[model samples]
Target: MQIKSVFIVEDDPSLQSLYEKILSYYGYTILGVARNGEEAVKMFVDFQLKPDIIIMDHRLPVKDGIEASKEILIYEKKAKILFASADKTIKDAALSIGITRFIEKPFDISVLIENIKELIDVKI
Candidate 1:
């Protein structure tokens, strides 16, 4: 099986490093990283082969996850984005925009890994 790829949109450096370490250990390729939502959208647009999943944080500078996900969906209607944020309020909104999943902040890293694996295993 081809290794799954992930694009991370997180502003916190520590969390970014943690995620890269854990996900890489699990055999997922880190496609790239984005510090904010606008960069996330731009990177998605520029990638020749889009990542299999996007780990998005809602409260981002420039655009926010919901907005960035919307913009991304316009370009790739079937984009699989997993909203990972502290904000619970945006869950419905993110789902409405076609995000594949939503996981609240401070979740277990194992859960996050499982979610990513589930997204990759399931046919879109």
Candidate 2:
């Protein structure tokens, strides 16, 4: 299925805004914004908002993305999660939890967009 909507779990405001702008430009709907994993879970549950894809940060307050993703995936097994982090340890942790895509922080916007497009195309 084509990824039309995306949920972003990012703690950094600047990066969050940049991602929102870039993804919106690509015609992907921004379902909601959460500053941390706790908020993300709350938003997902309260709104029952299901996005086609999820762009998550590895390090987050309250719960962290890996735990949140695990919980979210329990509800939606087909959930596609792309994790981003500056720390290799965090990325490794995410991967160990079965997260397939890992994007390094301070990434080029163009590269990020292309990766997102590719993930959406693959539908995994």
Q: Which candidate has the top score in TM-score?
A: 1
As for candidate 2, its clashing pairs are none
lDDT on C-alpha atoms for all candidate structures: 0.91, 0.82
Clashing pairs in 1: none
lDDT of 2 by residue, 1-124 (tens): 4558888999999989988999998889999999999898777776566877789987899988889988777767777788888887677778777676898887898878877778777755
lDDT of 1 by residue, 12-124 (tens): 89999999999999999999999998999999999999999999988889888899999999999888898998889878888988999999999998899889989887777
Task: For residue 87, give model 2's deviation from the true position in Å.
Answer: 0.6
Q: What is the TM-score of each candidate against the true structure?
A: 0.96, 0.88
Relative to the true structure, candidate 1 has a C-alpha RMSD (angstroms) of 0.8
